[model samples]
Target: MKISIPFLGVLFLVTACSQPQKSSEAGDAESAQSKFAHSPLVEHIYTADPSAHVFEGKIYIYPSHDIETEVEEDDMGSHFDMKDYHVFSMEQPGGEVTDHGVALKLEDVPWASRQLWAPDAAEKDGKYYLYFPAKDKEDIFKIGVAISDRPEGPFTAEPEPIAGTFSMDPAVYQEGEDYFLLFGGIWGGQLQWYEDQKLVEGRKGPTDGIPADEEKALMPYIAKLDGSMTELAEQPKEILILDDEGNPITAGDNAKRFFEAAWMHKYGDKYYLSYSTGDTHFIAYAIGDSPYGPFTYQGNVLEPVEGWTNHHSIAEFEGKWYLFYHDTELSGVTPLRNIKMAELTHLPDGKIQTIQPVN
Candidate 1:
């Protein structure tokens, strides 16, 4: 109809009429998901430096909580009452979860006189064992253990620090018939066995002493464990060194930043050892065929994405591999860290692909 229209009527038509934008919007969403498909899962968290393990069809995350008092003082003190050890359960598929408060606390353990941090938990023979680091009155970080019948625990502590070498960050793993505990800080490394000696009853040995350099050389060790939490062999020996292609990781710039929170994982015939590069805030990994040997640096597996640090763990859950790690919330090196989990897929080649953040 070629009828003349009033100015107001024309204005109304112009405001209401436009090209359909549905197709463009749909295209944008598809592009986003396609980009994010290779990325890690994102989440909000109250914990940091998380170590995860699945038990009885459920995943348990043991991390250090930022107590309010610790935040207020702006001091990562060596003593505190609010260690904030908690347990959470996630049901099959996806659903809301619940927090069971304070799985292990400082006062709960008889020998703990200070800060508790960096906890890792696992189950063996139907019993759950939590390995964590705490301080004595002297403020030195040492590793200890707690045991409970269930994953969510009101756990009981052993008589003393489980196996510590004036260090923190305890990681335990079961290799074949042996349970090996690998832990250390920048000072170096130590490995412990869960079998064979009388921990309570003293042992008579030679009073001979070793040189300072000889003592310092005693790190990056591996040993076998029996039913008892005692070393089945002599002191741990340094051996783990190998390349991503199963070659020896030689001493050089490629071998720089090889110390700190080193944890090993075995997948099929390859062994993956992940560790944090000190001060760089990046996570690097090495590969080996054996748990104890030369592991070649695979380079940084993951790094800070959008102002987040790459200090974390890559673990498998329900047949799917996931990277579970932490990041700072406040800008410029904030201590208030948050946990993140993302799915990890292995490439045809040996090296692991770096993970990206998901929306």
Candidate 2:
């Protein structure tokens, strides 16, 4: 099912009709649904691992800019060989998307060697911050920060990667005046190589010698961001995900355990932590009382998509919530992915209704 195509230079915009139509009856259930047709927000180029946010009343997306490359695919994500990032924005969900060319590039990062992976963005004190994961000169994944005055940016990178960051998919969540960074990914993302805050050379996972059924699942991490918003204020801590009975979800439970792409959002009084079930290809979530959580596994937010990886972001726009994610629909290849969006609903009982990607 994996097929690659030559890069296309032409830029095409696919307008989405994602707005919910008004109904005659007050609070009609049918009217509450979005009419969004699941399709690539942009088709001229490939983009993935969408980190969407609503800034200044507009929907801004920070996604990994995917390009066709000669690198062979591997479990360590050797094939994703992305070199840059582009910022996209829309007036609203399912609207015309604007691609603000080349927000940041690999060549521009002084400390990074290769692979500009999934990124997230935040705004503070009239400045925009772009948080991204890239392999440094040592070939280990480290999170870095870029700054800009505009949401869509020609961002400038810091002189070095954040001191203690050691993994991929950097997602930033802010509540009131506090900002937290949630991150980590295993396998090709190389999160497994680090233990006890340092690299454990030649470490292996379940496929090596560890028994999946008995080994506790690897968990994503969260650290408070200092007021400057560029570095972690404290040491990273594991965000444990447990089952209904309070036991940690085991590594064998691929369908529910965290793999990568950590995201956090708040609804009413509860914090929702969602992530990709890497190999299983599901986007699942858990609910916790706080941002730093011992969350209880809830359920899947999205079913399997058209590729081996599923990365997503959730944001509220104009009183409705949407799930932004990526799939290989355009290239039919795993690494070359395109971003898409769908309506996400939180039911009356606080559980997310599972979303099925449209064909």
Candidate 3:
């Protein structure tokens, strides 16, 4: 749901360059908190990119299920709207969410159609993997893994797609028994920032940047699933977006690559990597010690939502730390995003703190 990097500088653009003034009603952003609090958090429908999960103790939320299309004039084709995903849950920390209907859809995904975008939910061995992204039936754009032993789903897809995955947000991080997943960038060009040129898969135009020996083919891949978690048990590599003297961020310089949704967590021992800093509006991060990194960007934690792309996810549940994300300021357009959340701190010696986007 991102990709505007007007030339990489404003931190990396995504609301397709802005001019969007929308959001003005705060009087009743759902009565100002306490229905459960923290974020536009979900009022009736519209959601996007979130993907959190604490599971059995509650904090679920699979997001990316915003719909509102009377055929608006976004002309950029489908407006990235979406067909289904709703799976809120909550129960504690800021409490009250629960909406679990239609866990995964796009007509039940046979080879996919439309463009279902962003998703992630893992549990492994016991079963519950959702990793999504659609546009197949030859329209191309891979990424799919649906199985479910119940994480609120009628989910069952896996008839294909994921074999070598093409692109589009599809997070999934397990670590311990090893899971990984995380996907590619967009921006009309599946973006590769600087020397790695992209956008030519589901089609988008005019690129012309690949060099540094093709900069590891542009970066951002991961892969390592298997256990029948819907395929790709290995062979995906790429993550090396380095530079603090480690080198590897190509396209010539100005660094901070990886212009996609690409999340990934794990606080204490390090390894953050957040994303979505394409054309501007913020939402970045970097720091590394594993999980295929070469990272080191470390900056911009978020601050850019009033419509124009801002996909996110950074859970912690029961002990605090939230930050779902999305903002059209309530149907302010920008694909009518919605779904928000705030309250994410950390600035002691650990980093992260720039949130700003509440009611």
Which structure among the candidates has the greatest lDDT? Answer: 2
**lDDT tens digits by residue: candidate 2, 255-335:** 999889999999989999999998899999999999999999999999898768899999999889999998766666677
Between the candidate structures 1 and 2, which one is better when assessed by TM-score? 2
Q: In model 1, which regions exceed 4 Å deviation?
A: 1-45, 70-82, 92-95, 187-221, 229-234, 239-256, 305-310, 330-333
Model 2 / residue 10 / CA error / Å: 6.4
> Which regions of candidate 3 deviate over 4 angstroms?
1-60, 63-84, 89-97, 108-117, 120-132, 142-166, 170-217, 220-240, 249-261, 264-312, 315-320, 323-345, 350-359
Model 3 clash number = 11
Q: Rate the local accuracy (lDDT) of all candidates.
A: 0.56, 0.84, 0.68
Residues forming the 10-long window of minimal summed lDDT in candidate 3 = 1-10
Weakest lDDT window of 10 consecutive positions for candidate 1? 189-198
Please state the error at residue 123 of candidate 1 in Å: 1.3
Candidate 1, 46-110: lDDT as tens digits: 45667777778776767776443433431232222246476665543233444556788788876
Put down candidate 3 lDDT per residue, 35-126, tens digits, no spaces: 22345666455677787888788878787876656655532335675887877776676556667688777888888877787888898767
Compare candidates 2 and 3 on TM-score and give the better one: 2
RMSD of each: 13.8, 8.1, 20.9
The reply for model 2, stretches above 4 Å from the true place, is 1-37, 204-211
